[model samples]
Target: DAMVIQNPRYQVTQFGKPVTLSCSQTLNHNVMYWYQQKSSQAPKLLFHYYDKDFNNEADTPDNFQSRRPNTSFCFLDIRSPGLGDTAMYLCATSRRTSGGASETQYFGPGTRLLVL
Candidate 1:
């Protein structure tokens, strides 16, 4: 089935180390998003790409960055990993239909990061 997929489901990094997470999809959607979710909290939107247009959430930290090299692939780069930065990174995709409504976003399994 066409779906979003993330690599290296589990990652371990040291304090101040840089880490990169990746996502890819077969769904050919126009919008792709990255979210950071901490324990017992809501998933926070980090950034997204709407057909090459990049949009970053206002409150997302400077250390968090994203790149969508093409329609099917996106990457999340943490410039400097910290202890507090350990969380589940989720990637999703969706598109607005001709009916002028947004479709439901399909999410990947997610990548869990551990900082030591």
Candidate 2:
């Protein structure tokens, strides 16, 4: 089945180290979403890309960056991961209709980051 795939289900990084998480979709969706979810908290939208255009949330930190080279791939880069940055990073993909409405998003299993 076509789906979103995230690399390295688990990640470990040292304090102030750089880390990157990647996602790819086989469904050929137009929009891809990146989310951060901490334990016991709802997932927060960090950023997204529609085609090649990037959209970031107002409260997203500068430490986080994203890139989408094509419709199928997206990447999240944490420039300097802190202990507080340890959380689950989720990737999702959705198709936008001609009327400008987006369909349901399909999420990958997620990559869990552990900062040490």
Candidate 3:
């Protein structure tokens, strides 16, 4: 069973329009991540927040921003969505542990954005 959930499974927006995607998790994970995946391309890590410490990928565009108001909720804001921004926005959650071993991430269904 997936603990992560993303709202607005499908969305359509106009070019240059601002849009927001929401994600929430049932499990109280310490870390959350946002990824953008274009068709036939690998998902790119936009950013991740670990217990209020936000970390953005160096290559992530400035148009993308994220907020984690609380432990269970996170929001992705696209200031000016473009045609190229049309892609699947994925939300994932994981627990950060002291061990070096990799932790498994629980992913949401993802919100598909279509910019016209």
Candidate of highest lDDT: 2
Residue pairs whose backbone atoms clash in candidate 3: none
- Superposed model 2: Cα runs more than 4 Å off: none
- Residue runs of model 1 more than 4 Å from their true location after superposition: 98-100
lDDT (tens digit, per residue) of candidate 2 on 10-83: 99999999999999999999999999999999999999898898999999999999999888889999999999
Cα displacement (Å) at residue 69, model 1: 0.7
lDDT against the true structure, per candidate, is 0.93, 0.96, 0.94
Q: Estimate each model's TM-score.
A: 0.94, 0.98, 0.94
lDDT score, candidate 2, position 7: 91
Instruction: Tell me, by TM-score, which candidate is best.
Output: 2
lDDT leaderboard ranking: 2, 3, 1
What is the alpha-carbon lDDT for the whole of candidate 3? 0.94
Candidate RMSDs in order? 1.2, 0.6, 1.4
> What would the per-residue lDDT of candidate 1 be over residues 1-116, giving only the tens digit for each residue?
99999987999999999999999999999899999999989999999888888999999999998888999999999999989999999999998687756699999999999999
Cα lDDT, model 3, residue 106: 86
Off by over 4 Å in 3: 99-102
lDDT of 3 by residue, 1-116 (tens): 53899998999999998999999999888899999999999989999998899999999999999999999999999999999999999999998887733378889999999999
